[model samples]
Target: MPLAIVHQSYGRFGGAERVALAHFEQLRRMNIDATLFWSGLVTPGWQTRLKGYDIRTIPSTLPTPRNLATMIRFLRELSRYDSIIIHHHVDPLLALYLARNLGERTIWYSGSMFELAWEKWITGEDYRSISQTVKQTGQEYYGKTLSSLVLSNNVFDQTVRLARTVDIHAVRRYSKIVANSKFLSRFLKRIYKLNDTPPVVYPGPDPMLEQLSSKDFTGEGDYMLAVSPLIPLKNVDGMIQAASKVPSARLVVVGEGQDRVSLEERAGMLQVPLFLKGNCHSEEELAMLYSQCMFHIHLSLYEPFGLTPVEAGLFKKASIVTDHGGPPEIIVDGETGFIVNPRDYGMIAKRMKELLSSPELRHEMGQKARKRVLEKFTLERSAKQLLAEVES
Candidate 1:
């Protein structure tokens, strides 16, 4: 049977989209027919960034559920595909649409619940208490999907406790739940409260980064390389804050987003020499930055499965993963690199000093980091595990 990997959009080539694309490519290599589905327009840059897939885009908007007929028709078109792996941000409205027609063919891949925080950050209110219309929409979604699932699961307990009608539909409608990390697996069981524990299918690392060498370095290897989308939740501003405390340290922020203006202003006010490279054009350029950097640094508040640190590890660069979601699975604290408290610039500054001051320490950690990534995380391994989950 054909497989469909769905994400909201391909407007940008971020970590989540990379993972989704990686899954499509990996599964195809395993001799399964796979296609990538998106609901929004794919940016010109995305067309350049991604290759090798049958991509289909449909016009559909979330929250309004105004495209009910569109969804119904789309689901009908996808009748040939056996299942859909939803890369939802803990929002299961898509699964509800599928269950309304496709029934037990929906598998919601719960990556992280950061949407809850994003909602609070963007709008000063919880998602459940947004409006009467949204609440009614949530009720309609759950009412339709709950009966479709046959697993004797406690699909209602957590949603009832959380007091959100949306949660009830999102969690109960899925025929299967697959987590992208161990941290997310735990969050699924405890926070989302799924009766069946989701399987862990770690994201694959890009093969090109594994071949990086010092010869690739065309720039001075003096600055610390930090890759983030320069967003608030990414807490890259925290990295800027921490870099400011270390007078000698220079940070090269690689990636772009809406928060560039504020991040640049903050970097200037703090009088820190910050080099911002917005949306790297090619893998060669990204590899050059990785090969030349003294070390890698990531300090996101709620990182689901950060591929930046893993990419750094592939380039044999020592990395400090700041925060508690998926980095713990990748980095062995004080060995590969340190994991400091989220947004704690003081601790981040201290860790930065310890590694930056000592050349030997950085080299040793980078070597160990690469070794860990080889043994534990890779595209081949991730593909095999994920195929097994979806096929079963």
Candidate 2:
């Protein structure tokens, strides 16, 4: 029986797509029969990379009330596969439909509940209300009456309802559920009221990252490297603030988003030397940055799995990450790296000072970080665990 790996899209590439592609490659290298099914148009840079893979495209738009035939055909096509691993994020409605129809053969790999998470962040509303409804009312009552119960005109509330609908009705019914991190698994358990936590399959860096030979720097690099979209949620400003306190350490940010202008302006006001390298998709360029950096910093608000830290680890670099998210699980405090409160720039700076002052400590921590990554976060390890779950 052939295995099928389903991902939402490659149009807006991020950690999830990277993990999916890595898993597909690893499985095929192991000589397993696997085909990848995805939706949305492939972005330009990824076209060359995905040249010779058995990838099939699903229709971009979800089936509506008038498009019942399209939904039937798609489901029938899906049923042909022995088992399906669906990556959720871009298309919850499709995930919902697939779980409802093919629950027995499906394993839902949840990366994030961003629909409700972003809504709560935007509206400053309590997510627990929706969780309560889903938990107490169960699927039947909430599925039919959620529209009336939630504020119809409020966009955030509407999103919460739809997200909860999928959580209660669709996600829990799958044969198995895998979360990207323990942080996310706890959140899923709370919302779905599951008897046990969903298994966590930590994502690894691209295989190329692991294969690159480690460069031995004579001394610590002058700049601190950060690789994330320059958005408010990512807290690029926090890095700027932290860098301002440390005169010797410059800050280099590698990804771009809406907050770029503001971050640049803020860095200018603070008189901090900040270099912004926009959207670097090339592994070689990223590897150089990672190899020559003093250390990595990621302080995203409630980051899901934090693949950048893992990527940094592969390059033999320690990191300082937010305590609120999954990085705490990856980095061992006082050893591999430090986890600090995202909002506390003072604490971040303090940690940075500690690393900057001691080259011996930094190199030792980096070596340990690389060892940890090899033991825990590797494509081979993650793929084998995922395959074991599917086969069981």
Candidate 3:
């Protein structure tokens, strides 16, 4: 049976997409007949990346009411594959269709449950309920033979008002569950009310990191780093707020999004020496920047699975992440790096001062962080685990 690695969007190589794409490449390398199945338009840079890969695009259709047209096309195309590994979804209408139709023969490769659950609670009622393309019972996809429900994190606490336990229950009833971290799996089991413990699979550093030599990349001076798609959840503003308090701290943000203007304005108002390098041209450049930094600071209010921390770990740069989410899972508190409260920029600055003042502590934490990543999280390890689950 041929394999289909599916996702909502393909352009720009986001964190979740990177996980699926890495698996895609690995599967092909192992001689598995895998296809990159997606419905959206592939952006310019991604087209070059997928040049030799087996890609099959769905019919370009309207996407106003939750990609109903694409779902129709997806439904038409589902029967051909023996297994459908859902990497991500833009619409739960597809999940509803799959549970009622495909059932146990599916693998829900969850990047995050927040997107679907939150969307359904907000604007996806019309699409999940009564779309013009296909009408069915307003039930989420669940079945007896479900291969697995892979979840990145449990964002239930933040989205409680909008979503429900019943809604979470309907979605979590898979044959097996896969979580990206132990911290997340604990949240997953509690929130979804599951009996069985899910396996934790940490995503590795970007494949580009392996190509860069350590000698070629090294830190120049005392400057903190943050790599995030300039967004509110990433807390670029929070970083700026904290940076304004620490005069010796120099923050360099790598990545861009809609939140850039607002973050820039706030930084200007505070007179923080914040440099936003929109997007790294290549992973080599990104790795070099990581190497040059004293450490990486990631403060996400609602991060599911963070690959940037792992990348920072790979770069041998200690990652100072927010205590609340996946960063705690990756960073061994006060050992690999420090984990501070997401809402406390004062504490963030304090942690920054703790590391910035001591070069010995920074080196020790950086070494430990890199060792942890090398021992546990790697593309080879992740691909092997995924293949076992999919091929079993």
Candidate 4:
């Protein structure tokens, strides 16, 4: 029997999609019958790119309205596969419904605690809208009054607190729960109060990095690179303040987000030479920027696992990452890359100046960074670990 993998659509071409694609490639390579079930608008290029893969489009937007109806349709459609694997922070109630109908042996994959809490925190407004739509549709497919009733603030609070209970429900219904990192596994255990250890499968590097590293560095190496979505948590404003102290070094920020205009204004206020190059989707362009920069900077408040530092390392460029979250695990302090306090812009600028003045030191750190990634954090390693866990 073939494996059916259901996940949110590959939206905006971000980190999670990259992980899903890597899994898809690996399954194909292993000659496993794997299918992708997703819901969203897929671009033509992406569809063309995934031509060989078996893909089913669910007729609903993400955080789909009439979630119960969507789940009913999904469960009915998913009955064909012998095994089902769900990724990230999808509604587990749907999995419960599928399990009740299809027997209790489906697989469930979880990425982070951050995602489980996202709808409660950042996505509340969107969830409300989705719930309102579902309410109006008068759907009661998930043993509920309506989908809106399920997403109430009181219900959301109860849901978050009852995370452990839900996991127990999933454990009883599903075959396995696959987690992305050890950090996340610990978080799950604490949150769910579970004795069972979830499998730790790290995410892979960007495929673009492989092609990018094949070419030589071609840009003028005078600026520092900070490549991330311009969001509040990314600490782009802090990067600008740090760059201001090093007047000679330009700060080139790649990727766009809601905070771009505000960040640009902040940069102007600081009188920093901050260039916002919105969305460098092209790997060659990103590589050129990485190869030519003095170093890469990532001061995210929290990151599950940062890929940019590894990319910078591949290009023999030093990186400065925040002390918090997964970046500390990714970067080796004073070896591969520097780690700074997210709040301390002065120290960050000082470190930047120190690296800028010392070319030999930068080269050495860059080499160390590349070696670290090659040794520990590769797609092959990630795929093998995940496959091993699934098989086990």
Whole-model lDDT values for every prediction: 0.71, 0.77, 0.68, 0.70
Q: Alpha-carbon error at 310 in model 2, in Å?
A: 0.9
Measured by TM-score, how close is model 2 to the native structure? 0.87
TM-scores vs. true structure, each candidate: 0.82, 0.87, 0.80, 0.80
Q: Judging by lDDT against the true structure, name the best candidate.
A: 2
* lDDT of residue 341 for candidate 2: 94
Candidate 3 residue runs with Cα over 4 Å from true position: 10-12, 39-46, 59-73, 119-175, 213-215, 218-222
Please tell me which model should have the higher TM-score, number 1 or number 2: 2
Candidate 1, residue 98: the lDDT equals 67
| Clashing residue pairs found in predicted model 3 | 104-145, 104-146
lDDT of 2: 0.77
- Model number with the top TM-score: 2
Lowest lDDT 10-residue stretch of candidate 1: 144-153
Tell me which of candidates 1 and 3 scores higher on lDDT. 1
lDDT of 3 at 392: 73
lDDT of 4 by residue, 1-392 (tens): 47777765323445565567667766777777888876543445456668867788654422446765776777787887877777654444554565577645477666654333343443343333322123332233233454455557668666554644554565556677777766666656765567788877777675557667768676547888998877666789899888888868788998776677888998899888888998665557777888888889999766666768877877877899998667777788888878999879999989999898888888889888888877887777877776676667
- Give candidate 1's whole-model lDDT: 0.71
Give the Cα-based TM-score of candidate 4 against the true structure: 0.80
lDDT order, best first, reads 2, 1, 4, 3
